[model samples]
Target: MKKNLKRIAIVAMVALVIAACKKNQESAETAPQETVKNADKVLQYIKDLGFPASSIVDNGNEFVVEEDILFPKDMQIPAGGAGTKIEQYYTGSIVSATKKLNIRIFVDPSMTSMSSEINSAIAQWNGVPNSTLRFSIVTTAPYDILIKNEALAAPPGFVTCGQAQFPSGGSAGALVRINKTAIASNSFAQRARTICHEFGHCISFRHTNWAAQGESTATNVPGVTGTDALSLMNGGQCNSGATVLSQKDKDATAALY
Candidate 1:
């Protein structure tokens, strides 16, 4: 009887855990979608600055507004699109030219020492063809830089972490200026991945939605595919490190330039 009781207790505990997870998922789904909607607006505003629409890739979750942006219209919706058609922005342009990109990295004073790690990560990113980007790390308090510099206001809409600029001409360049909050929230590994991911955005790669290319069937997300799961481009806590580039990431880079 004791053994049977223990078995019942185990099953009950399992059920409780599943219930908790479901509730958490449900709660996430129910949070106000307003933040996401705002992020879409900011992205469109950035695109207006001369970047191709495909440049803003969404992380595959609700916390990131990019996941919900509607294509053509350039709008952000609820996560999973709430069963509505997923939206994406696409401007077909191969952004490759000699000296085509100039990237400036700004680190808060606390994050200043991370420069070497940042440089190492950027080097790997540069090794990827069609990247055509350059970077210089600057040490300063990021929040002060944004608040004090009229030129660098808060990112439009609601992207609270960081910002970038892609200017035109043969001098096409992208700048990634980060905030202290970003540094605090991200790990060393995460920082490296974030740099590459942002650079991926700088080079015009969109999220891994099967709908964008009109493929009727949904495929695995590029970097999240199977066990290989190596691509700086992949979302979530899992896709960090040298082994993260999926075949699709390679293809996307090749396609970009």
Candidate 2:
């Protein structure tokens, strides 16, 4: 009788352990599926914003579109869906007015060598008349953005000067990855332009010449339209684009902010 009781207890204990293991296994399986599902939603959101399918690259953890704009897998999708105007384009999403007044940039140690360039870029935005947008550098935590040097890769015959994520959740894009080596040969003005351009992305400016870049049209800031050959916000002209914001650029800035 005693032996039977002990055997029954052991069997019950083994059954409980098995059930717990099965439950954990099921949870582990579901987590990846959930992640994949969320990623799909983000991808769809990107498409809905008018980025052509061919322009979107699935870069492991995030989608890289139009060479410079990054859409992270976990970024928050806007609550009401993408906006609809198309020219001198914007993402429709933007940094909230309150947050725009003091967007903080944290320079990673890897990027300290380009501090002058970063400051120059920040000054360009800060100096925009009739706009309250500002960017200040900080040395500690609690920052809105992090600018860092990264050895970005590219396909043959092409180069990636830098990359910036777009704004989400009512804040600026969180990361800017500068390919210092790639742009090292560019002049100081051009380098600063690269940084400034990425900052534009952080605050929700798409490439001003999106149509020429072979991208789908994007939301246009009210009263700021048409091609801007000298627009600093133009992409694919990293080493040769406008180093300072153009008149229309300022107009758009004033209009949006």
Q: How well does model 2 score by local distance difference test? A: 0.89
Going through the candidates in order, what is the number of backbone clashes in each? 8, 0
**Candidate 1 Cα outliers beyond 4 Å, as residue runs:** 1-90, 94-96, 101-111, 129-160, 166-173, 209-230, 235-243
Clashing pairs in 2: none
**Top TM-score prediction, candidate number:** 2
Please state every model's RMSD to the true fold in angstroms.
15.9, 8.2
lDDT of 2 at 62: 92
Best by lDDT: 2
lDDT of each: 0.42, 0.89
